[model samples]
Target: MPTRPLTCTQCQPKLLAYVHNQLADSDRRRVARHLNDCPVCYAAYLAQREVAQELAGTIPSIGLPDSLQLNRMWLAIQSDMNRPRTIPRPQLARMGVACLVFVLALLLPWSLDKQQVALAVPPPPRAPVVTASLNVTASPESGRRALPPTAAASSTEAVIPAAKTPDTPSNVQDTR
Candidate 1:
């Protein structure tokens, strides 16, 4: 069929490479005699052989693992490909700050500080607690006379006008 017959626009592009036998034997005999005389290239070669038999039964293959689950997945990938390789958190914090600066440079000359460290002497000033309150005058016939802290701190001043503050509502009465 080759010597030149093709056309349902060249056998609709050689019907999916002639339904996967990838064409060549002289363009698969001119696309199998133009899919035996073109009913639209034989319904485009039965829709490219039902999409190459639904893509060769849509994939799903991987089945191997049985020898005791392939020897426990090859002993978990050969113990994760033979272990030991850690050290890197910035080289383990620069080897713990170079072993704390080589144990503080070998205890810096036996912790040197030959002189300066005797600061502990503060204990003297404590005397001002002089609380004196006197001018006691409430006297329903002298029922309460008590005012003597050296006569209420050597008394003298006396003009009481208005001093109230327990949130302001006391029976205030020193009208002088």
Candidate 2:
């Protein structure tokens, strides 16, 4: 049989088709003859055929598990079913006390008149102190120039007042 010659580029397209038995017999023979003579086409045909066969053999056929949705639903149900039902007793008591205090605070002013409640706090009690006396006398000559008196009792008990300058004598005049 006389064969029509084709380029490597042209033969490549029909190469797989020829191997898979999809091409017309004359076309297949032409491609097959080219593949046998050309190393590049022959390698490409083998790789393509091997890949096609491998892919056909390896495609997944089994379905995913059906329990996935059921597991998710069960978890959700368990979470909802097992949620905490009651607050701790102490917390509940504290909440009740707070509510009561709030209500009392709100109602207290309305229930009491200005005169009924006094806001003034009582002053704290004064601390007690002990007082003792001792007699002391300044010398008569210097007595007339006596120092001021203070709370601190004496040589025996002299109470010397804090120092304050005497007012200017009325008779003194500013000469400046």
Candidate 3:
């Protein structure tokens, strides 16, 4: 894709990426070119570089591991180096057994639950039918006021007014 040239806004964010050499070849080149052309972005890049340098200088150095620990690590490394690339027969067998046991553990309960299933649960009894009279003296601006808030909240037979059809006379307001 033909990317648009980087503006100050775009270049500002990538200064850190440019400073750290984290930008891709094309992106790095673009950012480097932008830095040269734009003094403001170049200043930002310089600031980022300075901050990186300061951080590098102040980082507390870690002391090397002790000789015994180093020797143990070397021995472990050497042992791994001498070992065959493919899995050993005995270890592979043990791993296979472990995986089989895990699969059985997972599947056993599911299989048992399926075969020895409990009686099916019955659905709850249907809700009692409710009837209430609602006086909806509502306008478009006022909206519908079907009974007081307390009465409407408990009632199940709350009726929503249907939209006006084109056949309805404009003079006769729908009370439904």
Candidate 4:
């Protein structure tokens, strides 16, 4: 009995197996029949066969070298395989630098936040005693009282003295 005509899709998969003579007799016969009847399938089979033949011809057989040479090559390969691999010094240095930068990147914002917190919080309300001593004074001659000379000299006033202009002499009388 004659089999139904096989489509190109059905025949394409079996082509490689057929070219290599790897298919069962029944399947090979079916594919062979299809190739005989279908020009497109035949062309595809021919192309596949040509590629297989060319590949077989072009690829050199890899036979083992002489035993001594093969043994030496294997020993060299084995020694290479066994040797410990280490990162190059320059690459390790780069990695160390990268790690340092990454750690700094992670910590920078936190340090900045700590500084901001320090700035944001008003210094423990200057101890009332210190504030009172700084603000109130015994001198009544000048309606505006002044801190004791010692306290004034010891405070920030000592660090940054008020600038006196050249025209304004030190002996100038207070008009206030």
- Residue-level lDDT of model 1, residues 23-56, one tens digit each, is 6787788778777877877986898899878877
Each prediction's number of clashing residue pairs: 0, 7, 0, 0
Q: For residues 1-176, write the lDDT of model 4, one tens digit per residue.
A: 87777788999999999999999988888889889999999999999999989987887354535788889999999999999877578978999999999999998876664334334433332222222133445667877766654433232211222234554346533221
The order by descending lDDT is 4, 3, 2, 1
**C-alpha-based local distance difference test score of model 1:** 0.66
Model 4: CA > 4 A from native: 62-176
TM-score of each: 0.21, 0.33, 0.35, 0.35
lDDT of each: 0.66, 0.69, 0.70, 0.72
Summarize candidate 3's per-residue lDDT along 62-121 as a digit string, tens digits. Answer: 454578978999999999999887856898899999999999999886675421232122
Position 142, candidate 2: lDDT: 68
What is the TM-score ranking, best to worst?
A: 4, 3, 2, 1
> What clash pairs does model 1 have?
none
Tell me the lDDT of candidate 3.
0.70
Model 2, span 137-172: residue lDDT tens: 466776576555445433333333222325323343
List all candidate RMSDs to the true structure.
19.5, 17.8, 32.4, 16.4
- Output the better candidate (2/4) by TM-score: 4
lDDT of 1 at 117: 17
Off by over 4 Å in 1: 1-17, 32-37, 51-53, 60-176
